[model samples]
Target: MTAISIAPAATRIPSRHRITKVMRLQMVNRLTYLGIPWIITGVALVISIVVAVLISVSVPEPGRQAALEGMAYSWAGLSPFWYLAVVGVQAVSAIFPFALGFSITRREYALGTLVTFVVIAAFNATGWAILTEIERAINAAGLTFHHFTALWFSEVGAGSVWLSLFTLQIVIFAVASAFAAVYARWRAMGMLVLWTAVALVVLGLIAFALLTGSAVPIIDWLMGFTITGFFAALLIPATLAFALGWAALHRAPLRG
Candidate 1:
């Protein structure tokens, strides 16, 4: 019934946790949850930066090459993006679970979700930092940073200039939750189909508009679909739907 991310705290508590214990508990939980994301993010960032620098320094510059010569460098440039995506997916995987945990179990669930989001946040941050560092490194090398401008991309599958392009950690969680809800409610794939349809339509529109002129404004709006915009877009909805689910669950609580 409740989301794991935004459930309210219990009114009743033991005398031991009157104040200090409560504060201690919250802090402890926050730190405990944060550790995983931070560690994972750190590892991924380090590896990505090292790999990118290696590739960039190793690939010898050419006098003149084909149209796609930039593509090779582009590929080398993507290591950071890969690391970020890997970290991002991991981060996103925690979104619903954290929300679900917060909604259902009160403090315990909240704690779990907190830890998970910390991990997720860590990855998101890591992915971003790696890309920023890579760009700076490339700039320092006095080379052109190609295919990376503003905030849009040709495809989610293409280019790594930006980490969120490939994987918007928060959106995945939101979409995943929608899918899970559909699956649980009707054993249907309506959510999946809807998502697919939405993707196709959006992509088509972007392609058409791009052919005619820059669609940076449109793409920027769409970027809100990313985790960076999850709080603004999905969080409110997620919390609201979660509240409705809570009412239903209480009327007929989850079966043991």
Candidate 2:
């Protein structure tokens, strides 16, 4: 007879450690955390380089004018990474059920999901910082390269720039996760009602602003805050979104 060995049940790690393990599990073989960001950044940088070279060689006149005018480049280079929010939705729809089947609790699922979003956001922010520095160096060397830094971004300090980017991405991911949780719990009917209410509130706000002539003042007031301040303010909403999302996930149904 072969010898058999068994471990004691009391030897298992604590629940918090188990939850963290669940969180790390999501990151395994995951592309949203770093892979998609690198792909988007690489493609955007390649396109920028090619376009800059082409304009320099063929349409040198406009290129010269733009360089002289101190025109900023597109700040939308990393916008593609924003789709990670949608991926968050899909993760819940797909991963939550599988995780539940494996005996993971609702809290673990929610916390793991949150950690995954923050990690992805931070990784992208780091990539943005690296690209921004490279873009500045290239332009400083008189190469006329304008890819990462916009005029607005240039006005902000480098630390603020990266912090704002990281904070904004986290807030967006949190909101998206909440929206996804709503739909996952309520399905199509719930989503329709949610969107309808959102539209009505938005329209009412717009009408009120136009009627009262506060739109321009509102815009001006908004523009007064520094980017860091704006992102810091968003933290409140982000917290609410995360809370709501976690609550929804707590009672959400699982399906194949």
Candidates in order have lDDT scores of 0.43, 0.76
- Model 1 stretches astray by more than 4 angstroms: 1-119, 143-167, 189-256
- Candidate 1 per-residue lDDT, tens place, 13-91, comes to 5543433343243335443334544565456546555554655676655622232234334433233333433433332
Top candidate on lDDT is 2
Estimate TM-scores for all models. Answer: 0.38, 0.87
How far is each candidate from the true structure, as Cα RMSD in Å?
A: 11.0, 3.4
Error at 35, model 1, angstroms = 10
- Least accurate stretch of 10 residues (summed lDDT) in model 2? 67-76
Q: Candidate 2: how many backbone clashes? A: 0
21-127 per-residue lDDT for model 2 (tens digits): 77787777668556776777788778877776766677668556575334365655656556777676766776778788878888888887777777777877877
- Measured by TM-score, the strongest candidate is 2
